[model samples]
Target: MSIFNLIVALGAVTHKDSDHERVLIKRIKAGDNKALEELYELYKSLLFGMIISIVKKREEAEDVLQEVFMRIWEKAHTFDENRGNVYSWIVTLTRNKAIDRIRSKGYKTQEKASTSVDEPEFSLEGDKFDPLETTIFSDRAELVKKALEEIPEKQREVIKVAYFGGMTQSEISEHLDIPLGTVKTRTRQGLIKLKNILEDHISRNG
Candidate 1:
């Protein structure tokens, strides 16, 4: 799916998967491949989007995604639903695997080679502001996008650059010609405002 459609899909998925997820995991533990397929269908977008953010390449993210499910299949018996839900467990596993991939010698070497060439800077308003890449919950992306519009322009700009633009605070400082401290301050303030705005939006809508 296009990123736009993906964001819509993420938002449309209500937080009602707990019971269904538990059943899927139970079946998976019992060696049901169909259950595993059902689980994959449910979470692939969120997982793959997160992997892309970390690994920075669609192909590598796809490979990492397959590896993640394989591990899940092998480790299904170890899952403890009482401690946490399946979504949390799978997301944690995917993140760790993606982090490991980036930390590997081969991946490091490849990343260096990939970044050796200069690349053009992208505008946040242009094509790169994918909501899925941000730290916000994927399942609330559309709401978060609307809530973002309600924040002060300055705060919203910094938050968007930090998250969607994939830039560090220092990078944002240099790019925006602002102090590093200012960048940090804006990001923190922006996130706090965003949380409040998002919560209010959710409450009102529900």
Candidate 2:
């Protein structure tokens, strides 16, 4: 699957492992390190892929991935199922951390010193993805493609820049010449529409 497709597919299959992940997070909240490991195993590929897409460096991506889980282990208590599902929460968390890493001075200096600006850091053209992650994204991309196309173009633009382009809201605002609040509004609205579409798809598929 294309990185674009997989990034968009991040939370599109909310029903697949919802219950089991929720149980894992609950256990994690209650001080179960093993549950955290289980959660890490369950999501590492998908999350790491997303992080590498943002940071564009394998080593930095790996460090950010570790920091991401540490944050999860520390803040698992803050996960609110009433607001969103576990998948979306963790995806957002991973994306935010990745963005933060790229914005750091250390990352900027390292990036400036690197001579591989022309080379791709991560590629899905080979056996880079775990077979199961590939399958999950492939199955959901078909389901999400049409629904994603149905949203307003403006909302879709911001969503694409935020997710696939790995740009934060402030950066997106600057890039698109829109106010930061407008960018946030469009992103939230687009995601709400997408979430509703996925939930409807889940019900019908069942």
Candidate 3:
């Protein structure tokens, strides 16, 4: 299905009955491949959107989605409904897996060396700001924007350059004419603050 259709499918599943989800999980734990397929049909789009939001590459997201389902299949028996609903569990699983991919040594090495010699500087070109334009998943883009608004201005700016702009710390420092240490500090502090804010938001809304 197209990405747009996938997002709509995700929205449809979001409000589905929790008991039905729980039953599906139970069946999955019992080695029912058909139940697994049913679960995948319901959650694949939602999880795919989430993976894309973090990785920003369709191919990588697709690979990660397969890995995520594989993990779900292997670990289904470990899920505890008493602690949280199935949907939240799946979301946490997907986010953690995506973040793991982002932080992987191979990914870091690739990201650091990926910059082309003739690459142009990342710029806004004075265009109007739009959160949806920042990410494939509009809901995640909004959450990120809201979290950014709660951070200090300097930290927020550095993070945007480092992450959304796909610039390394040194590149960000040189581009902004700031000290490398300062750039690193802001990136670190900004991420910690953003994580706390997002965690709180999720807790309140979960």
Query: Which residue pairs clash within candidate 2?
Result: none
lDDT per prediction? Answer: 0.70, 0.73, 0.68
Q: Give the per-residue lDDT digits (tens) of candidate 3, residues 95-161.
A: 6688688778987786788673222222123434342333323455466677788999999888766
Task: Report the C-alpha displacement of residue 34, candidate 1, in angstroms.
Answer: 3.4
Q: Candidate 2 on 38-136: residue-level lDDT in tens? A: 999988877777777667677887899999999999999999988777776787788789878988999889878987843334435465443223323
Model 3 clashing-pair count: 0
Using lDDT as the measure, which candidate wins?
Answer: 2
Native-to-model Cα distance after best TM-score fit, residue 23 in candidate 2, in Å: 1.5
Residue 129, candidate 1: C-alpha displacement in angstroms: 10
Better of 2 and 3 by TM-score: 2
Residue 7, model 2: Cα distance from true site in angstroms: 6.7
On TM-score, the candidate that comes out on top is: 1
lDDT of 1 at 73: 96
